[model samples]
Target: MDIATYTAFCLTAGPLTILMVIGLWKLFEKAGRPGWESLIPVYNVYIILKISGRPWWLLLLLLIPGINIIIGVGVAVDFIKSYGKFKISQNAAIILLPFICLPKWGFDKNTRYLGPSATISFHEKHRKDLQKSTTREWAEAVIFAVVAATLIRSLFIEAYTIPTPSMESSLLVGDFLFVSKINYGARLPITPVAFPFAHHTMPIIGGKAYWNGIKLPYFRLPGLGDIKKGDVVVFNFPMDADSPFYRPVDKRENYIKRCQGTPGDTLSLLNAKVYVNDEAAITPSHGEMEYMVRNDGSSFNRQLARDLHLSDIQQFTNQDFMMNMTAQSAALLKQQAGIKSVRPNIRFNGVYDPEVFPHNPKFRWNVDNLGPIIIPKKGWTVKLDSLTLPIYRRAIEVYEQNKLQVNDNHISINGKPADSYTFKLNYYWMMGDNRHNSEDSRFWGFVPEDHIVGKALFVWMSWDAETHKIRWSRVMRMIK
Candidate 1:
């Protein structure tokens, strides 16, 4: 839990509840004398209408705000006529009575009246009606349900609309997706400003200065082994978590298309084919580059969409077929739709290296090519002169020089205690299944495992650009 999270909770629950209360009060006009007496909880005896010489139990109407105003005026009129003691009759109370008291109606304390003990018979007849004024109850229920549901959704599963083609052919713009918070194990609620000075993250200063700042209960860890190669996954955007815009956690804007290159394996994409540890990757050909999933896409998506239809399939014609998004949003959508990743699990020969190994083989790598580098682990150690690169050196500096500060003793990376510190978080190599089209780890480098969100379980729906129809059959189909 952090300061921002707690503030959101209070804004939703506390102040809103109080506003509902005051709103109800303003309805019945009970702020001011005689029938104004209905505002007294115990004195009203659960049936406050008799005090105004009208039907009993209009008190329930007092629970409603807008309608309460109409009823309050009616009740004030009826009570005045019943009071022979005061010259202020029903109509007189509504008009001239304002000259004396500002409220000019019921619920005022200063005014006094002697009204007839009438309406006992009317109260008895409509007792059941008074008990159930469904209109008021239903209105109140609707207001509360909407408020409660919004709170749950904001904190639990937030719904996002995809906006680009990078992850295209999979996630489309206007395609609504729900990202679950608990999927990556959410942080426990911590009071934002508990201890002071230590959690000193005040306005002008960045977050570092607090004592009891941003603490979590440290519950169960996120699940392991769920994310596999070729499985679409979402994660927090690495470069800009602190920006004013809380960007999508998915790798398109923050999400991307990348082939999974496993630990200890050398991988690369030369020309247009993918290679994992010097072996060619087996890919699923999804036909030509017409529109996949949906038919109603731009001018470019029509060809493949029709081919995938394979003739017998029905055509889609609904407006839901195409997503019209802003330029920025469209970029994100395109990335999501761009390529389909295939898990690297089989053994095959490299496209360039002709020396094939029947069982296991090894070969050299290039700039457009890669591999032979070992996955750095918790206990791994290396001689600075023996094996050194800019990336490796940077990692060492982060783990040893910046993160670890031991008193006259060497530090460690991750949990592997050692005289020679090593890798901190688990790391992985990611690349686009579309060899030439993706910008990935081969360029920016390895991804840390702590950023993982969840394996994309399924392709929920597809839109056809040509026919402009939504394909219902694809909904809920497991990703291959």
Candidate 2:
């Protein structure tokens, strides 16, 4: 993280931490334990477990990532019960308003520590009032199951299905994948209060699934490794921040693509080949692109097209055709009868593509031939000028949430005149393997760090909707 981001996080988390500590200190003293015990880290958790009458071994569960949340909530509920608070509203106060409720209960003249709520004797004495109906028992079970599944899905792995052909031949449409959040660190939910298992919309009812009233700052746990070039990643769509569809970062639509350029790397494409820092980047073996094929005015073979996995085949004339297929498939098609030539459909350099990134006439860039532009790194400052503004404006003003304006050949950020700007978060360049068919970074721009979701690990299941059957060979196949 950059210094700016770190400072912002500290500013938000510091006050909350202090309040919780003060609350815990008083509560510990009320339990006949040293108030200083609340100041310690792991030891404080141990004390909480002891006060609630939970086993000492439960401390080990607190060390876990996803399971820790569940265990901590249980411990808190039991601790509140020990204070003789039994109402559902009181339990919610203890869990959601701990800084307020804990201190309030601890300092109250009438509030006194009873016995450990988890003990058998306490439960036996209150058994008459605690008896629950079958319906209530079933409801509680369902609630626990939902919370457990939500935690696992948010912090460990999530199931995602391919809905487009942008990653075709690499990750096919209808492929069900298990994306690993731990690989690139599990990003804590920015919109925490949401319908379980729903992305951004309610099922069977057309409405927002999440409440936007409470928004959390972006934070992520330590991951196994950083995102590298060629890693398949799932990220929230950045364009959803535009007008008429202003969605929060986490609530944006999810998109999967291959990471072609990492932070601080200079990336470019020439003749449909990717280059990083002037060196040829690794290409996906099964990646596909459009190819122009010419024939001897003979009828095309439908069986040959199916066998080669050719998609979006369009015939301009009896002798001219265009198809999307991998290089290996193209080579095989070239050796067939009546085929005259098969060549990549690459757009020449200096051809301006308005749909491409930056969208400037000065660049004259296209999908096949793009920039040698540098991907922004955290703390990397760039001089603000007419030429660079078009490239970096959206990232600075939108993603980083800054006020930027250009007036009379001058630049002003946050209402202050500025000649340069420093990026707070690292930025990446993503591209689809299906070069001719994807609306990726080549069209939109950089992907900020906060928009990243997880890494695509493997395909657990694959279905071929066209044939109404399963692709058995693709099942359990690990993504490259």
The model with the greatest lDDT is: 2
Q: What number of clashing residue pairs does each candidate have, in the order they appear? A: 56, 0
User: For residues 1-480, what per-residue lDDT tens digits would candidate 2 score against the true structure?
Assistant: 545767877887788788888878888888999999999999998898888888999888888776777788888888878778876678778877887887788778787778785346656888987898898788778877887788888889999999999998999999999999889888998888888899988999878999998777888887889999999999999999987768899999999999999999999999899999999999899999999999999999999999999999999999999999999999999999999999999999989999999999988999999998989999899999988899999999999988898889999998999999999899999999998999899999999999999999999999999999999999999999
Name the regions of candidate 2 deviating beyond 4 angstroms. Answer: 1-19, 39-42, 55-64, 84-92, 107-111, 117-119
TM-score computed on alpha carbons, candidate 2: 0.93
lDDT of each: 0.42, 0.90
Model 1 per-residue lDDT tens digits across residues 1-480: 224545766666566445433432432443233444445563543333554556566766855533444466556555544332233233443433333332333334544444345344444666686564678568657644653454343234444444544443445434545554444443222333232322223447554333343333222233334445565555434433335532222211335444365544555645334566677865423211211224233333445433332221223443223222223333333454532321211223343332221111233332244444544544456543323333454445432223333334443443444444445445556654333233456555555554444444455666555468876766665544
Cα shift from native, residue 204, model 2 (Å)? 2.0
- The RMSD (Cα, Å) of candidate 1 is 17.9
| lDDT of model 1 at position 286 | 28
Model 1: how far residue 10 lies from native, Å: 27
